[model samples]
Target: MRKWLVSVLLLCALPGLSGVCHGAGFKVSEQGAKAMGMGNAFAAQADDASALYFNPAGIAFLPGIQVSLGALGILVPQTDFHGTTPLSGTPPLDTGTAVVTEHSRRDIVIAPTLYASYALENLPLSFGLGVNATYPLSKSWDDSSVFRNQVQIASIKPINFQPTVAYRVDALNLGVAAGIDITYAMVSLQKSLYSPVIDPTAPAPPFGAYEVGSLGLNGTAIYMGYNLGLLWKPRRDLSFGLAYRSKITLDITGDANFLATTPTGMGAIGLSDSALFPYTRAHASSSASTSITLPDTLDLAIAWRPTDRITLEFDATRTGWSSFEKLEFHFDSPQFAAFNNQPDPRKWRDVWSYKFGAQYVVNPRLALRAGYSFDESPVPDQTVDPLLPDADRHSFSVGTGIGTTLGSVDLAYMWVHFVDRAVHNQEMTTLRGSNGVFKSDAYLLAANLNLKF
Candidate 1:
């Protein structure tokens, strides 16, 4: 029973804590500033070291060795939740008092990347390497937020390293690359507990109401996965690229520690902490374990040069979100013998995103870029909650760059607008008996320096 309780704690404590350099579902579309400026439409025009991530085959056509460094900073607007939700019995005020809980977030988050490429002096081959952030997501709600019973804080960070190679067959440019990812995640939530021996016969508190004994759970984990890419060029002015990133399943394992305030039943009966500490309760402390799968993605793109100074590109991506339809938690304690496999329904569906971008070169040292993308949400309206208030949206971007004797520096910015979502699910797991409207916006600034010898 003790082991079972621990498993239940871990199961409820884990969900949606992973990503890849993205699009919807905690993903970042651009790995470098140039790609950021072009709305990640560089798959076929992967000319720089960033090609290690976009399309490794393009590197086979380059000369000499190149190195690049870049960073992307996301400015997230507050995610507002105008509604009430289930609580784990953690109210800091009287039940009759009104509560005001608005939103959750941080002002800024950053993702960094590094890339290097070397073209063989006499061979039709090139080699490249890249290290970058594939996914970064962080959000924290007030301890008193309506959904406090579900989740108060969550942060997931993932990084990937890729080694790429390309071979040139006359007019054909063939490329392939593989990657390994390492991720770390943490989540904290509060749940109300009861002293059954003292109050088992008493009426249960209102559904989703907070009681005195609050259980806070937090955990951490690390895991790995691999990805590969392909690029092909049939003509001088047009090219095609494809990439497949595999799913990463995280076997998250850790320990859960419980922190309780004052017990309502204990205080009501005049008993104190010293007396309750000696009891062998299932939730006092225990080990945690669960499994989570990050989705996979397939990208198809084309880069075209219709004129000497103008270049155009487009990309279509399909994500395997159906894999997350149900999340299961495996427990290790006996307290939860009756319930072993606690399954949470995500019911997420496969989604698609499309991007288009254009670039113009005015001179040897200056260039300009612009692009746009349309993204679809995987979460259904019935399941949307403050923890993941996502909706269909669009992304617009613009950028400029300059070249010098040593290297070129590119700067780009993007604006993301999420369509307001009105959630009306009477059967929701958390926000029951309530309706909510979610509004959010975000911005990204990316910069990269490409140096060549």
Candidate 2:
């Protein structure tokens, strides 16, 4: 029963609810900014408790017991949206018209993580375990003023669990780990507009309420995936690492609610005479279900220690976002092709990230770290929307750690600046019910804590 509950929560908590970043891309990079600030290139450089998130093998080297925790803040810019209805036939009496609108918020979110491990004194091998959230940030928007033609989306959060093991041989070491991921997600979409055609046969004044739809939709499901990582210490001062996270398939099933006004109901509600325009004369609800694919990822990293007081590291990673090209759903009857026959053209060409960082040892009990990285956006320009407002980004980060006889404490801050991106896809927006060209910008902050015994 707990597993079933977990499964349901996983679907409802994951997916990012079309929260932007090109589909569900934002959910892909939710690690604390300290890791992100370091370019997420710590696989080989895993020495601290946080290493549990990237490579569980690193935990084997930990002596005694240790723990770590922290949080991060993130912001993404909004995209421009525009839509137009091509007029083709005869002209009819019209009472109202539809216009375009937009909205972008600089909202920030905080993410936290925890890690623990123990080393055996009598054995040549070491074993460890940990639980932490990798994907940990999200955003939302619902402004009627700017998104008149666009679908309003709200609430997206996805979390996960990781466990691992490691061993050492002379001067070299190796390790492996796996992940048990859980997620949950919910969404609300709405589109409203005015049209200037009123039928004399139609009940009252302005032709009734022709506008609302899908006030809310929620889905919950459970998925399974794994993680593997490798670490090698070529010399006392040099270490290298590699890791991979498998993809997850989400099967969402749930209920939906919709609102609409028609000739029969509008006249009775006294709204038939309120406006002059085109309107929908029906409101209803239905069952909703969908299947979506999350992507997989691979990372390679290196760490170097030229002196007792300094360490330098670098990392590179690839994400299989291209695997997520379309979302399909099953219904009780004929399926509503909400997205049209548009095969997800998101050829999301694979992307790569590069990071460089350095940690300074001020003393046996103190350390400071700093890093820089460049990331590429996977969303093609034509499909960018509120569902995923992704763009190429630049990230910077800094942090410090204090050691104690029982454990250690770590703190970090990261700043991500999203370049302004403009979206120009009339057909794409129409499929998703959006108004015009879209544009936006964003930022983020983060923190973490670690303990050892």
Candidate 3:
């Protein structure tokens, strides 16, 4: 039973590709305008109680209690392909030919996060806590008439929650945190290129007459990890901050079901016996388990506040993508091989992200913000598939805030431009695999709010 459970969990980490939907970076740094201006390098400075996540020790200066809430919207991202294909012995023709066309459009995702903090009043030491999320993975592709009769194979929709704590001294701060990493996974795919022996002269199967299914699963296991940071102020005008976030491994488990399908008398339930057909119903009914591991990551940052009204920040991050080189699955039932050994094309590489930002106070009650960042892609060119269209990107952002006798509030917006990425990606099949060269453009718009009492 334990081994079976392991197999189910591994299935969760199926393929590591980040298209506009899956490959995009997580931008959860919607904190105070002061933090956003400096590109969120609070790990070492811990300017506010929220700095605990950035640097627990920074919380040493935070007075009383503070709470915050914010909303972020990732605008409609866009990615498409335009290129040529070598047409050889393919359907309705002979060998030695080339074809060219465009890739399909992808969907948009909107996600949000919330946080709160409290500081110890009359103690030499201070403590604080917060909650947020990270983008694990996603995929979406729909181009069936092309080579390999490609069908969208998307394993998108994963969300994570993080809770943490910190401690502080005069000019230096340090902190650590741990929590449950819950992930909801859903995978959809199709095998629509079966050359049935049906009499071509007799009749053609209705265009929509194909087999399909939706697999929904939940992995409810507690994954644990921690983070560390330091902040120092050598002088009034000179200060520095640094932080390290540990890695986490999430083992998820849930049921896989067939949401919809067109039956063709063939299997136990009179369904067509096609290769790509996911025996999810059979696997679920028979207690077939599916699972996978979420990788770990590291973040380093720095901030410089020249004046009480002006500040600057920068950061660099690395994700444990190397931990996802390959995937393997096992079930207590025979259906395991069909689902495990099957083609799950994914070989993701580690990635690094850099951020630089600035904030200016226009007046005592209002402030403004702006910044830029460069993020690298982990997807290799050789394995670049249409489903997981990932590429390097550049982001530009701006925002503002308001202060009152009671507390303060902040908001920000960003625009991300993915560098022009053009590559040849192949979709593999049992008999053979066909390649698709893709190109795309994407954008993101985000906002955040903060409060203290």
Which candidate should be chosen as best, given lDDT against the real structure?
Answer: 1
Q: How far does residue 375 in candidate 2 sit from its true spot (Å)?
A: 1.2
State the lDDT of candidate 3 residue by residue for 1-453, as single tens digits. 222222222232233222211223333444444454444544545565456455555655566666656545554455555543322234332322345565554555555555566666665444444554444233344434343223344433444444454455543433333333343433333322221212112224431212222333333334455666555666665556665655555444443332322222123222343436544332222233333334455656666778888877777777656555554433344433344443344566778778787767889898787877777777677655444555787767777778787667766666667776666543221212235445555544445455667
Task: Point to the candidate with the largest TM-score.
Answer: 1
Q: How far off is residue 261 in model 2, in Å?
A: 3.4
lDDT of each: 0.66, 0.54, 0.48
Q: Sort by TM-score, best first: what order? A: 1, 2, 3
lDDT digits (tens) for residues 162-275 of candidate 1: 776767775545665555555554444443433312221242444333233445555566667666667777777888888777787766665545544444333322234234
Clashes (N, CA, C under 3 Å) per candidate: 20, 69, 31
Better-scoring candidate (TM-score), 1 or 3: 1
lDDT of 2 by residue, 157-186 (tens): 545555555565544455554444454433
Winner of 1 and 2 under TM-score: 1
TM-score of each candidate? 0.84, 0.77, 0.73
Off by over 4 Å in 2: 1-24, 28-37, 75-102, 124-130, 178-210, 262-283, 333-346, 428-441
Model 1, C-alpha of 388: deviation from truth (Å): 1.6
